[model samples]
Target: MVAIWLDGRMRPSTAASVLVISARQVQRLLRRYRESGAGAIRHGLRGRPSNNRIDCGVRDYALAIVRETYADFGPTLAAEKLAERHGLTVSSETLRKWMIDDGLWKNRAQRRNFHPPRLRREHCGELVQIDGSDHRWFEDRSPACTLLVFIDDATGQLMQMRFVPSESTFSYFEALEGYLKDHGRPAAFYSDKHSIFRVSKTEARTGHGMTQFGRALAELNIEILCANSSQAKGRVERANRTLQDRLVKELRLAGISDRAEANAWLPTFIEQHNAHFARVPARPKNLHRPVNEPASRLRDILCWRDERYVGNNLTVSYERKRLILEDSDLARSAVGHYVETYAFADGRVDLRWKGVSLPYRMFDKDQQRVTHAAIADNKRLSEVLAYAMEMQKAAPPKMPRTGKQRTRYEPTGLRSPGPKSLLAKRAERRVAEAAAQAVE
Candidate 1:
């Protein structure tokens, strides 16, 4: 602009408009340019220190106090403490820069790890991200619980959500069952490499090669994807953060602290949430496929399905319970072979031979006591402790039993029943809807 004005092509007022300065300032700049050339364009106080800078002595004292007493304190807290105790008032940012120069603190750029962003899926149901966030949702009104979240990657929709005691296999099973019933089978489920989703132990000899949840998805013809890092499943991880803020407030507003009540009312919240936040997909298509299998089949698939070797006397030992198969041709046939066991969420176990249910009688079905040497995995420690407490409440005072009876567990197995299976509840709801439609 100065060059333009010097060339006589622009009026002083025009220069003022272009430079966002007063016409008087433009005129002064023109005079300065003619007298001193390009150097006149720089501010008069370009290299001078600010009049607002603190005294050298004061800055030195502040740095000395910070280094001597509050070396580990953050900038904000240090500022507060300086003002309260030492009668010194320095802005947090100013002190932050000083600390950075003194090697007392790392800058934000140096402190944070960068994660590159990934594009969302093109269709709503093409990739559904799932996660379990363990938090204190009730704010002292109730014990902390885990919230299982299912969110669509493309639309950012809250496809499904439920509260459970913890992030266990059965908890995920219940949540997955609800999601399947509501939105059908998504093309794939993206999740963190949790043991429930992926086999964390590579050399373990259990569950063959896949987890129970993985096997269930295989049966449903859906893909289970494990993210290498938490940032990889950023969709559901971010959703968990948002829900920790918004859902907790909503629960407080409704005075709902119980998991059961919150679950019953979550559909309304989900609808409102989707209305406010869910977006249109890049491609206007939903990739979710309808569930072709019956509810019973889904129930069997979702439950804990493990194969056990049948003994010589047609007996199967499961969770320390001796399941003696009723004397029959099928039971005798399975005696020397492996029979599949379906452990339902409702604590019912079914022994099947090649997809055929075999009747059995429970003998010596007493709960196994948890021993001191029993290595409870970190994932299930809370549940194991809770079971131990419950067993202690009902157990009679007696000397420690010898032999295999040292660790008797409660009747409710290690992973006890969570909320009843949503399968039956959803089926009843569908039937009621059909009945109402027929009446109308």
Candidate 2:
């Protein structure tokens, strides 16, 4: 995005140069601006306003047509439909903006950044990002399915792999179980705000609680972190995209497609992939160690949702509804039905009551209601994009058509102080947009 922005306008090429971009970029930006105006310069489509956006009425009528007829169509196809039916024409980009403005566009959920997601984790294995991508990973060789991927944030190691339908606690469990069986436990697991990792309404945490996945990590003495921004976990996500492209071919070439066969073939893929792509760490191998728990006990750590509650004394009360109801003999006291405060390996708290989970909360005995000391979440980018289109605060001061004096041009928000620096202005906005995109 920044590269596109810095293209075209001329800037010095010195160390003191405000924009350290290439000359070709300047020409491109200039061509775009000339063709599309400031919109082009801002990376928007350049050219005359779409003939379809001829007037507010046409725009409205076109939108109405879209909402009623081709509502489900993607922007490009919808634009074509508008031209064919209403004889109103507009570029897909223009239609997209109109739909976005009207809140009719799809809202893809994005996992955000660190609690303070800073740079890469300070030490190898300090933060291991785990995520799953549902894709045609085997290309035409196999049916589409999800690949569970665990990547070490510090060293960029592809630590573990598994195949599943959708990314779920069970899939993650099976993968993490394998990881633990091999590499042991890391300091923490980094992930997106998936329901398993997040405190959601469906399974609210006890005033003191933890999610099931969080509980497992806590049991293994590992921390759990959900990124504040999706890009914050770019290590795993970027890897997912890369693998979807590369690994799919490798699988196809090897003539592997069946799910079980794919899974069987993954060990060979991992070894070859790691050998070619893995990097030497700035630090040595991580200090992770396996849990010394018995096999049965370790398997218990991989469970999904289980009924639990808090005791009257504020202690976690739990019962077994699964196979080993009598394994601990504690289920005798816990069953008929009871609750337990779920302790996550990452150390969060989850309180389940009457078979339903509640949101994590902090309560003041006096106030007696739930409260979150931390802010809920950040605002949506669509809100800011909408705000970007607000009309000027006051009517445009008309240039006197009657003016005999040569016109003196004044730049609006596009200029920097003390001098005309279109180059620097573009650079500033370019950087700003990049930062905003990183968070989204």
All candidates: TM-score? 0.66, 0.47
lDDT of 2 by residue, 1-440 (tens): 43443453434343124456665665676568677776665634455576544688978998898899988887889999888877888999989888877766764442232355456665667789988787877776655677889988777778898887556566678788889887887898889887778766645545336677787888889999888778879899989988988888887788887778888888888888888877766667676876798996785577654554434333333332211221223433444545545544343445444434444334321211112342222222222233333422223433546655457765576745487489998999999999999999
Please list the residue runs of candidate 2 whose C-alpha ends up more than 4 Å from where it truly belongs after superposition.
Answer: 1-118, 202-208, 308-440
How accurate locally, in lDDT, is each candidate?
0.89, 0.68
* Top-lDDT structure, candidate number: 1
lDDT of 1 by residue, 1-440 (tens): 88887789988888899889999999888889889998998998889988888888887888899999999999999999999999999999988988898888897889998889999999989999998888899989998888999999999999999999888889889998899889898999998888888888889876578888898899999999999889999889889999999999999999998999999999999999999999999999889999999988888888998888899998998998888999998789888899999999899999999889999999995677777788876756776788788878878646875666636654654675677678988998999999999999
Assess the local accuracy of residue 322 in candidate 2 as a C-alpha lDDT between 0 and 100: 18
**Model 1 error, position 126 (Å):** 0.8
| CA displacement after TM-score superposition, residue 436 of candidate 1 (Å) | 92
Q: After TM-score superposition, what is the CA distance of residue 435 in candidate 2 from its true location, in Å? A: 79
